[model samples]
Target: MTGTTLTTADLDPHRRRILFRAWHRGIREMDLILGQFADTELKTLEGEELAEFERVLGEDDNDLFKWVSGEKPLPEHLKTPLFERILAFRPEEAFKPVV
Candidate 1:
């Protein structure tokens, strides 16, 4: 199977939880942002990267959205290469929607 193809059950509990959290954020916009990132990138993250991702997930959704969208500067703790990677993510360029 392709790297992008994964069921939540196929992942370990930690990764599965992150994926679910990503897809179920209260705001639709944050859902799309983190959900796409989790789908395409979560399986590839290293231990430290996963830690960073989890920290990000623990944040308040609105603040996370603002940081990712550059409406507010990322706090020092949230400033990591992985966070930058997430901030830079763009699902529009990554996938072609069914028309």
Candidate 2:
């Protein structure tokens, strides 16, 4: 009772499908974003830069969702807009549902 809630079953079929699609899209986007980083950019990162990137990637999926949805404030050092831009990429328009 003290832990996180499990509410996946509460979601309607269409909404659940949308959530699944978004989650998959987000994962793919993260990969592409990381790929865009040059060796120099990654190598040049030190101290806080490296730590922030590590922390962001280390977060669990639920926390990651909260962070992306703006429901939770990202750690100050890890709040780089660059990472957000990378993770927000939409490679496949087919996955994008009409709103």
Candidate 3:
């Protein structure tokens, strides 16, 4: 899909904003990674997890992409379980061969 299928109608303000940001990250790679993660996980995230997600979203897309893709190691401060979740949350479309 070109964009999120998750509806924001029932989401809290925080989640709505976070979802939008996740989908609109500067890079399409990051957008797909984070946006798909948010689409599946945002509704279930509790307050702390939401906070962690927001914090992770604040990182530079270049560094976040490297960290997520394993091209570079996660910095000490970013080596949290949430980041691990992000590392594992690969949407099937992300791996599809480009045409």
Candidate 4:
């Protein structure tokens, strides 16, 4: 057989469903972040900055939990610049978070 390129629609039904669910979850997560940062607009960060913001936010389990839980304030390093970066991120420009 000749080489064939497979697109998302070419996936098996089960795989397609899984991908759809994953995409949905990602969108939901982005929505949650936006809601949490209601005062900020999301049209500022570029792709690379958003990637860095995600990386910093995801650094440690405790860090992620603390940021999400509001139990601990985000550190100045992460909060001042990184959080702003995240708040200004557009989901269309975000790459999927690495598992």
Candidate 5:
């Protein structure tokens, strides 16, 4: 998917906003990473997981990029299941060589 294919029609205002932010980070790499993750997981995330996701979205895109790309060690504060899920999420299109 070029970006989020998931509809936000069922999401609450907060979740909808988060989904939008995920697909529109300053950098395209981050946008794909988090946006795809949100598309797959945001609807099921609940309570603290959802809150943690929101907190992660607020982090700097460059830092998030480094962490997700494994270019930098993830800090203790950022160690969470949601972060791990993000690190593991890979949009097939995002990693393909552009022809």
Candidate 6:
């Protein structure tokens, strides 16, 4: 816990796991995608949405990326509104003009 601090200190165990996992999903793009999701929407997700997110996390990085990017058809079980929201999610810094 040496590097642990205020980031997830106040969160419950479940949220802490989700926050950590979202930011450390192996692939950097996936990390940023899910990490930003954790930062903004994770806290507000309903139980079913949270469950859907967990299912999304269970997917392989390449497949998830394809699904999120619409490069492949979404499997019926994975095509929830929450997944659609992930598809719509744009990182806050994405559209910023570099100085």
Best by lDDT: 3
Give candidate 3 regions above 4 Å deviation: 95-99
What lDDT does each candidate get?
Answer: 0.77, 0.45, 0.87, 0.43, 0.85, 0.73
Predicted structure 6, TM vs. truth: 0.78
Q: What is the lDDT of candidate 3?
A: 0.87
Question: How well does each candidate superpose onto the true structure, as a TM-score?
Answer: 0.80, 0.37, 0.89, 0.33, 0.89, 0.78
Q: Worst ten-residue run, lDDT, model 4?
A: 1-10
By summed lDDT, which 10 consecutive residues of candidate 2 come out lowest? 31-40
Candidate 1 segments exceeding 4 Å error: 1-5, 92-99
List clash counts for every candidate, in order: 0, 0, 0, 0, 0, 0
Indicate whether candidate 1 or candidate 5 has the larger lDDT.
5
By lDDT rank, best first, the candidates go: 3, 5, 1, 6, 2, 4
Which model, 2 or 4, shows the larger lDDT? 2
Can you write out model 4's per-residue Cα lDDT over 1-99, one digit (the tens) per residue?
Answer: 111122345455643443333233223454344323322332244476545544543356445445644568777666666565554553442335657
Model 2 residue 68 lDDT?
55
Candidate 5 vs. true structure, TM-score: 0.89
Q: Can you give the lDDT of residue 14 in candidate 1? A: 84
Model 1: per-residue Cα lDDT over 1-99, one tens digit each: 222345876799888888888777766667777888889899899788898888788889889877776789889997778887887785563234445
* Candidate that beats the other on lDDT, 2 or 3, i.e. the better one: 3
Model 2 stretches astray by more than 4 angstroms: 1-26, 38-40, 61-77, 81-99
Our tally of clashes for model 3 stands at 0
lDDT of 3 by residue, 23-56 (tens): 9998888889999999999999997888999988
Better of 2 and 3 by TM-score: 3
On TM-score, the leading prediction is 3
Give a tens-digit lDDT track for model 5, residues 1-99: 446889878999999998998888988877888888898999999999998998998999999878777789999989987787787786666666656
True-vs-predicted CA distance for residue 53, candidate 3, Å: 0.3
lDDT of 2 by residue, 1-99 (tens): 211122447655643443333334345433323333321134444576655555555556565645655578876755586456534642343235457
